[model samples]
Target chain A: MINYWIAGIYPRNAKLIESTRLYDKTLKEQFKKEKSRLLKIQSDNKLDFISDPLIDWDDNLRPFTNSLRGIERGPLTRYYENNTFYRQPIIKSKIGTSGNILKNSICFDLFNKKSKVKIDILDPFTFYDLSANEFYKSEEEAVNAFAGIIKKELISIKNNVKLIQFNAPSLARVVERDRLNMVKKAIENIVRGIDTKTCLNLWGSDISNTFEEFQEFPTDIIGIDFTSTRVDRFDKIKMKKGLACGLIDAKNTKMEKSADVIRELRNIKNVFNPESISITSSWDFEFIPESFADRKLQIMKQIKEKSKMMKL
Target chain B: MKKFPLATQEIGSIRKPRWLVKLLQDKNVSDEVKEEARSDVALLNLKLFEDIGLDVIYDGEARRVEMYEYSIRRIEGLQLAGKIRSWDNKYYNKGRCTKKVKYTGPYHVDEFLFVKENANRMIKLPITGAYTLADWSYNEAYKSKEDFTIDLARKVIRPLIKDLVKTGADFIQIDEPAATTHPDEMQLVVDSFNESIKGINAKFGIHICYSEDYSNMYPEVLEMKNHQYELEFANRDSWNKGINHSNRNGYESFLKTFREYGEKKEIGLGVLDVHVDEIESPELVRDRILYAVKMTDNPNLVHVNPDCGLRTRSRETSFAKLKNMVIGTEMAKKKLQL
Candidate 1:
């Protein structure tokens, strides 16, 4: 059988929205109470990966709420006040604990033994680039600390998960040739410590050199960002395993047709034949509106059908 | 008498000469229009600078459409596909493939010659940095931005800087606004700066703005694991609408990170925010300068400037902003006893 895999870019909107609300509260007591509720929901649902809900919802409240004061020429204030902006006090308690939240929610229903879909969890890079703090003198030290946390987290989920991909989008921006070498070293250090099946996610307008730098790493899968870079360039790079073909355009609001997507996929097939192939986007689907996201999902479903029919 | 007098000259636009244009064009243009509209306009720009009594005068980049665009025009094997519509609705031409071309004319030498000949003042040679050129273009030929940027630095930008030195240009400004946008890529930016000035005899400077999310400039700072300041500094009240949270109060952090770059080179700190139309006061400018000085600890190395290119603002706002910047620099000098 031609092995085919489909992975949704991790950190869905519902979880992200819930996490943002939990991060808004000042009181630790309220935060704990909300955390339990959100965790309970996630536990019931069974999410593969989750993050510490750290986005401040209150920070977004002004721009969102002020836009509702009849001064703007857009949507109604009541819809924004009630629906668009989520600021419930109970929700504020469970922020950043999305993995537990997903484990406790109705999503767990989708994780039964009979489920054919394998879940992949994506973790954001802990300390690739950051400012030196009072607690940490250098970013390398901070990254090492984060790597320890990531190691613990990955060990906990390795039993059930199929893949644990680390999103190191920061690596793409390294301008210096030597610094690019350093970024690769950091990625290798983090990945070597993880005791699970893992992949590296890369994004940027330019990826030609990034792929070459990362070729030295021990990742099982190599994800290419076709959103910005051309597909023809992928043929030049030598790869060993699966190619996470980002065929979908995530940045634009307009949905892409399956025919156009299939054309791009067919072009990839001509070059490197891997053990398995999967379809994905260059970045998160949630960056766009919900309606656009729905259409994108629908398009992916259609692409899956076409992939089966045109089995290589 | 003005001590250490600075001179200025206008580099002619980077366009094909009239004879070349005449040979290539399908339709012919009148000789008078080519000489008057194109050549005289370039000459007039240089003359205007000479009249202003400025030490270093330039043709204000009259020959080129955009700095990045002009650089790409020299490189071959790139297809001008379509335009990428920016968030602000401006469209920039996107390149599809990477092809190599012969380096025929000197990138900035023609402009240098024009300035040297016409202007009595010392000329300032401005060239787009390798990082900016690589960041702005579509990298169809190279594997990554870093590789393309390094290649540009080694093959094109470095050699061009050397040529400027040979021609006796006094000062060279490597314009690098993209440096702030990708801080993780700062090593590449720094490498390019080093490559450009390597074995150069002239004074070198880097111009950067502060309006965008400068957190990326110090990837080490952004990767700080703790959320202690995230709660206090990243709150809603602290946020300004339409501005990235990292841009809200990142200047202090930006300065701290910039200290790594302070060992050598004078940094043109964009004290005034160019995006907003509001005119900043000398007091505010002084505060900005003082902050930079404290972080850098070298008053001689800090130069007051507007965030980026002033083309975006109105003439009135631009003038007011520059005047305020001069005042702010003076105030900072007084406060710091420099």
Candidate 2:
């Protein structure tokens, strides 16, 4: 089986852009309308799972930052290598979840109540690494506490959510190989009792050497950026879990050919046979413009249709 | 050159007057109305900075919409895709260069000449730097980052700068907020900045704002062709009143690192935290200044200013910050009895 969905905040259209800037009464109206429009766009294109554009989120870290008990929104920090910026989550005291962490994140009022929803959260290690840890005593303890926080967050949203995606752009930046096991343990802790499917998406770094370590992880799907990591990097590893191949470059305005994407995916499927194959974006479409992001979605749909013809 | 021990200058921008902002944003307003409004605001801003006892000031960049768009819109061969958020809901119109970009005209020259005509104090022309232009834009045409930045310097920025210098604009402040964005590309910044002022005989200083650690630029930044480097320090430091190493901890890396290089370049020490409206007391600003001076062992090498542009703050708040900055510098000077 093959699945398709997006991972991060989609680029805002003209209406959403204006409404967000104004931040008036029209903000909620525009947001609800925009969410429906995005879900419809994906539904019409035949994506296996659908999600809100995350228009309400300032970034992926907002939900946790806003809902967590002991975290404060700190000064603006660069979001990875991109031009985008986000407030660093400052840990002030012992971590605790106060309310529904997904209250602001997932909106059921816009959904059909039957949509296979996909939610993206910063992976525990990446969250721990990106955060300013003033309270935690050790790296292991902080990461475990973060994992517990994510587990609690997932447990609340598990009943309706179809896929819980953990985006780990900083996962491959772990220099010490021993930390890889720690990350694996964190991943296991999040999805331990949750019945829904999950994807552990890793990108922005070539995890060629650590490919073997991820093959045994608890995630049902392990996503990799084919651009950052050469397709042949995982040629030897016969993955136990399914694979999500990030074929589209999200940062640039340039369009990718669907035929080229299918050809690459075909080669990827031939060697490292997994339970299934899924196509995704390299990271967020937030870096690109709205018009270009829509065009990229069209290209993603074409790749899905063409993959059916190959029957690989 | 060091006659003024602690000179003060507005970094780049001041908040546009409310009525002027409205006039500029109005689609029905005539260009004559828009131009007159900007000129009036510019005149008032010059008086405000001067009234605060600033030794050097500009027209507060009232004529241009911003540091980036005003320059980016004037360049040819680059098409603006759409608005993208930098922080909060603040948007910058991102552009893509499909071919070699050239300056459409010297838009800043007229603005510079106008400021010189109005302000009695020493003035600076704050233009966007080449590395920042290349870093902020999507460079599809240029072969490499170096090629893109160099082209922007030699083709776009240098020509406009030559025209400004001809208009009696001797003190040029090149605003490069994205200079140390990529720590590895510090050489590219030096190369492009050096290329921009190759033959021009003007006092060029680089103004770097909020970004990654400026410490990354050091060792490499020393090679850049410029006399002074103005940077933001108040954002990281506290507002407490003390000249000790602990109170002025924000400038610790800067003081320690620059001392290694012998503190040759004049350092623009930021005293006011522009992000907040709470003004730093004169004593606090004095401490921030005294600490930098004590570490450098030369009060002449230090210049005091706000952290970055005051474009986001209200006009009243911006004026207050500058006034306190002047008072604080005076306090520092009195203690030294210079």
Candidate 3:
């Protein structure tokens, strides 16, 4: 059986975006109004595992930069091939994440008592790769320090969410064999005692053929960004666990055809019998305008409904 | 100041006056009335630049709205789609190239001529390039990027450059922030740039804001049809206002390459960081210019400018930054005995 869910930060509606620019204090009522609108959309789709759309986040790294004790936002680094930019996290001193950074960023008021959620954060290796490390003596130490914060944060929210997604965009590249082991070890330490389902999401480049490297990661799911990986070569690829099929195009404004999305789902179902499958985006929805992103979400709903009827 | 080695100049745009912005946005205002207001502001802006002692100047771009949208609205076969995010809170209306793009100039001619009418210094007119327009737009009309860029270079932008030359525009700068965005598109940029200036007889420059990687543009960038390469440096450098080696570290990475080209290509060195409202001190600007002059090994080729644009800053901040830039350049000139 499979489910549909959205991952990462979402775009602010036009009115909210306008208000954010002018208002020093966030319009809480209006903010909640827009967030509830997003929540209603997800609830209408009948998915147990849900996301908040993370409207408060400027980028995936922003909220954490403020929460963490030793890091600050640096220059505008280009976010992959897209025209958008994200502030680089500069790890100035030894990192200490005291509070629940992820939990603070999430809007729980919009969710009902029964609503389960999915939490997204950068994995240890990916966080290090994205950051400008000034204090860490070695890559191993930095990865471990980051893994410590992830463990602490996950412990706080493990009861509320259905799954924990560790976004590792750096793994989308051709990593050295030794570095892959380091990421695997880091994830192992981060999720050592946590019983919640955890997935490692990778994107920004094609690592389809290199799926062999991820075989040892101690994760419940291995998410692949299908937009970067060739879908035609799905026959040759193999998967051991759940596959979060990132079919939605994050960069392009053109909406995806539901039939095309279903065809790829069918292709994956035939090739590998994974434990679970989820429909998601290749990257954050922040790249697209709010108007288009909302329309795309509706199209994704259609794809999920059609796939279920066809017994995907 | 007779032979200013590090000649100060304006890059991109200055902050638009609040009154000008309000007048333009007011729906009840007539187009004719808005035009009159903009021209009046342009003259005031020109005087502002002159007061700051900029050797080369423009009208601070008060007459146009944004660099892209202003041109996109006038050109044929392009429709202005609503706002698209350039950065946080800053939106530019990104248009889609729905058909073959055509040049319906004098898009920038009136804007440039008005500044020329008011300016008392050498004018280096900044116009958006063909490759940038092609790259930035949604390419639904053209067969491929190459085709769209070539048509843009040859058909659209080339005609405008020819017109600018005829109108006594001395130095024409083609602003291509998207030049090295995609490394594979480097040669195409070179080809399209040469096509834009194929037979035009005028001094030209290329502006690339915070290039992803300058190494990729390489020898390919040198082949382009331009005289100056105006790029960002101060954004990446240290904020420390000192003449020490580490203070000017950001510009160190590209100096050897600029030195290799030597006086054959001029370096429009950006000494002020426009993103920050904190005005750079004269000492900081002097150190940056001094460092580049020594590193590039040719004082004659370096021209001082802001890293990108001061348009993002407030009017007061832009004025202070420019004022300090001129003061800093003079201080460096005095030290160099030029």
Please name the candidate that would achieve the greatest lDDT relative to the true structure.
Answer: 2
Error of 2 at B293 (Å): 1.5
Q: Which ten residues in a row have the lowest lDDT in candidate 2 chain A?
A: A98-107
What DockQ does predicted model 1 obtain? 0.03
- Flag clash pairs in model 2: none
RMSD of 1: 15.5
Which lDDT value does model 1 have at A268?
Answer: 71
Candidate 3: residue B50 lDDT (0-100): 93
Residue-wise lDDT of candidate 3 within B1-338, one digit each (tens)? Answer: 13335777898687778888898899999999999998888898889899889999998888778788887888898776555556666656667778998888778889888888888998999998888887777676887889999998899899998998888887888888888788878999899989999998888888887676666687777778788889888888898866556777788768866666544677899888888888899988988988888887667778999988789899899999999999999998898888
Q: What is the interface RMSD of each candidate, in Å?
A: 14.6, 1.6, 2.2
Worst 10 residues of 1 chain A by lDDT: A74-83
Which candidate number would show the highest TM-score if scored against the true structure? Answer: 2
Best by DockQ: 2
Question: What are the per-residue Cα lDDT tens digits for candidate 1 across B1-338?
Answer: 12230111222222333454454352577655653454454566566545543344555565555666777676654445433322121234434336442244467777677767876666666677777776655555776667777777777777787887788786776776566555456677777767766666666555543223454545433332111110001111112322232333534555565566434334455555544577877776666666656666766555555555554455467557666666666767787776
Error of 1 at A78 (Å): 32
lDDT (0-100) at residue B228 of candidate 1? 10
Could you tell me how far off, in angstroms, the CA of residue A87 lies in candidate 2 after the best superposition? Answer: 2.0
* 2 versus 3: better lDDT goes to: 2
Q: Model 3: runs farther than 4 Å from truth?
A: A24-26, A45-48, A233-235, A270-273, B1-4, B141-144, B260-263
Docking class of 1: incorrect
